[model samples]
Target chain A: MQYIKIPLVLAAVLILVIVFRNRQRVELRAGSRVLVLALAAIAIVSIIDPDIPQAIANLLGVTRGTDLLLYLLIVVFVLTSLGLYFRLRDTDQHLRRLVRSLAIDDAIRKDGPPRSDADLGPDSQST
Target chain B: MESGPTRRNDDVWVIVPCYNEGPVVRGVLERVREHFPHVVAVDDGSRDNSASEIAAAGARLVQHPVNMGAGAAYQTGIEFALRDPEAQIFVTFDADGQHRVEDVMAMVDHLRKSDVDVLIGSRFLGTVDGMSMSRRALLRAAVVFERMTTGIALTDAHQGLRVFRRSFARVLDLKAHDMSWASEFLTRMSEHQTSYEEYPVHVLYTDYSRAKGQRSINSVNIGVDVLINKLLRGR
Candidate 1:
């Protein structure tokens, strides 16, 4: 069996970047399990038949199967990071609104609710 | 309690963001309460007795259930204060006993007299007490960085003391949850074309504040957050 060096290196880097997210996050636990299974199957098939990747690489005008895998891996890694980053930010924003409303509601409840007249006032920040 | 030359403006609502500052916050609030009749303090999930201290100081207390950053605390306090239709001016103060009531009074006066939308307190333009050389250098670097990045011509990069008209606050929304909020505020001011002025304000750097202040390394995190956020906005 011939040694494939590049995909191993690419996979190693990919593993290092996203391993923590797959392990400790309960928020994404359900989705990650399915992702793990799918990735495992793809990795297995790619390892079992290197010629399949080579043929696809030839179709895509790539010289080596490992190089194509590396390119795809880099693209996937970046896309995953960007998607997760924005999702986490959105979740944070939602949590902030939740906590803020609870705090403000508690304050208003005890301190006599703000006069209802101001409710119809033109407050542009409400948007 | 009302002995000093109180600029007791009922139209002004002072917003204090209190985080784990149980010991020093009461004194700070007391000083602030002397000048301003209306005060809103948001305790950002303090582990200590800051909430009770704020209540004891007679400031309206808003408590976050969990620890949000100082920026979020300020936003919560501002939104709470904005509920009052009578409130015409809004002020942001630090809970670390740094900001002076006099500086706030001066800034509020400036905001009221001038046509500017917001008045930001600048220690470099005034006096910073007990600041170390290295911290001063870091802050100056931040000012330069702010000017280069946002071109707002600010003398100070991160200061808690600010006064803005109710009109400005009505159109203001802050997105950053942490130290990056200072930059977010600047960007918003520029984006909205909000007229602004810098007031010479005094900042006291005590041993307690030194312990509580952010580390220089945190600037790296703020830079990354702002950069990625700007990218996400496609600007």
Candidate 2:
């Protein structure tokens, strides 16, 4: 138990530091900031008294505190990463659209307006 | 025989998104032009001579610099049409020569008479010749999935031929940039409460079209895309 406490506390502190550093690059919303704080508080409490997480896990049907924390952390990490992945994909799509639109605009300008056949008598075939 | 009164050809825009279909797209454009002269073909960065063929066919051509996907091409065409006040009806047609012009005419006719916002061509309701048994099963599964997610029981949820009124077209800002757009379109239709009707339409599944159509395994990817879209939109 003593050996596990040192590693767990170190890991929790490392996560906090990484998250703090990430905050400089990404502006954490109020809800996310509160969530991070709560997670940090839980980590600190669990490191101080390892039995607390174990008791809660026993109540929740999970056997071990480490196992429960690991499960929740994996789930949250997966969901958050998925969310960020989707956001990055969407931004890429928008950027691609912007570039495509620019290319289309250039083509349209060079070829002239893509008017309907009814509007084009003889000049529309120039493109 | 004429079914009902249809809108004038001048007011409608036939949007065909062509990608590496240089061989057949011109023929499709010509057939569509016979009925509706207002045609726009968005060439999705085809390395082939599709742009030249589409331009030669006399359809209005919008060239994307790279392959942006069919949904993006449709968005470009719809946006282009909406820029003009004269464009009333927007019909999304395929470049693979599968969709029939008569079906589009009938859909436009229905749109003109009914108060519906859009008309979707249902191959299940009509004839879909040469469709493999596995493909049919896949399509049926897709219909069931779409029904479960969108609460809209469509006979052919993945059909490419859809006619949208200018108003409804303006309302539908499509987000999906791939084959998933077909499924996402239904979700949006449900989300916007867009009044839609399914019309029977013949689909000629030629060897070329079957080869070009979506593979059965891609259906799972489409389902995931729809789920992600719903999640991202917080719906």
Candidate 3:
């Protein structure tokens, strides 16, 4: 192992141990953490042994190892951006429901509720 | 012929989703209340005095604290109306005064007399007072898209004036929180096997309405949103 890899790998392993021990419910966060750690490990390993990524890249018909990493970075960036977008959409939906209920509750409080079904029509009376 | 109880206007709830159209909303609600007394104007975080305008028009106001889109506003209004065990019909009207209350009256009458569960007001089937070429083209393209995707033949797809019975509103379950909700509504209508028909109604475009209405370019955002939503939903 290279001089820089020694401390970096040890730190990564320690962080992974703590994360694995702490994660139980938040599967999304845990999965993302694992993916980030895996990527970081690969990056550190590539720095330590430049020929490994180059050999893999050559086998895959790529001329350079850094080019392979670039392509992967593009893919990972797109995936992460899309994941954030979907989460934002879900959070927005929840916010809408919360605001909607609050609006309805306040309206009922101020307006004294909608008129009863007796005088309106047969529809509500039947229900 | 059997005698069925004629539906009254008090049972219909007109859900006017107002954003910043403070100037014209009160006038529209006034005309709407002339025919249908129970009008619920949903104020979608308008910076203007639309809430007071709604109150001034004698319509009940349900207000969003933050600026949710028109779809969210309409959904809030629908939910608020649904609370009243008395509400039997739900009408989604624009607050910018493009929609005519006369058309609402006619559509409500048609829905009551017929077996249709939803009456969608179509400008193509009726008349347009003033329409730009690009606006008309965009609307036509949206119709074609709806036709190909949902296989639901409609002359107009994104018209804001829609009247549906309370029974349909109860199970609407709209997911889109923005203008994309229009397409989502059509999508769900097919899934629900709703008995729907298009009614010819006049749509008049004014300077204020044009300024306040959505840009046709937002259709691109709506398309992406719908596609991504479908993909994420895995349906």
| Residues B36-105 of candidate 2: C-alpha lDDT, one tens digit per residue | 7678899989999999999889888888888888888888888777765778899999999999999998
Candidate 1 Cα errors over 4 Å, as ranges? A1-50, A58-67, A114-127, B1-7
Question: Which candidate would rank higher by DockQ, 1 or 3?
Answer: 3
Candidate 2 interface RMSD after superposing interface residues: 7.0
What is the C-alpha local distance difference test score of candidate 2?
Answer: 0.82
Q: Score the docking of each candidate (DockQ).
A: 0.23, 0.17, 0.27
lDDT tens readout by residue for model 1, B1-235: 2433333476788999999999999999989877776788999999999999999987889999999898899899889988987789999888998888889888887888899989999998999889889878888888887786677888898887889988878777777899888888888887788999889999988889889989988988988887766544531
* Tens digit of per-residue lDDT, candidate 3, span B122-159: 99999997899999999999999888766788999999
Q: Which ten-residue region of model 2 chain A has the weakest summed lDDT?
A: A118-127
For each candidate in turn, the TM-score is: 0.80, 0.77, 0.84
Candidate achieving higher DockQ, 1 or 2: 1
B-chain TM-score, candidate 1: 0.94
Pairs that collide in candidate 3 are none
lDDT of 3 by residue, A48-112 (tens): 99998999899998999889988889868876775666567778889889999999999888776
Docking class of 2: incorrect
Off by over 4 Å in 3: A1-34, A116-127, B1-7
Chain A: TM-score in each model: 0.53, 0.54, 0.62
The backbone clash count of each candidate, in order, is 0, 0, 0
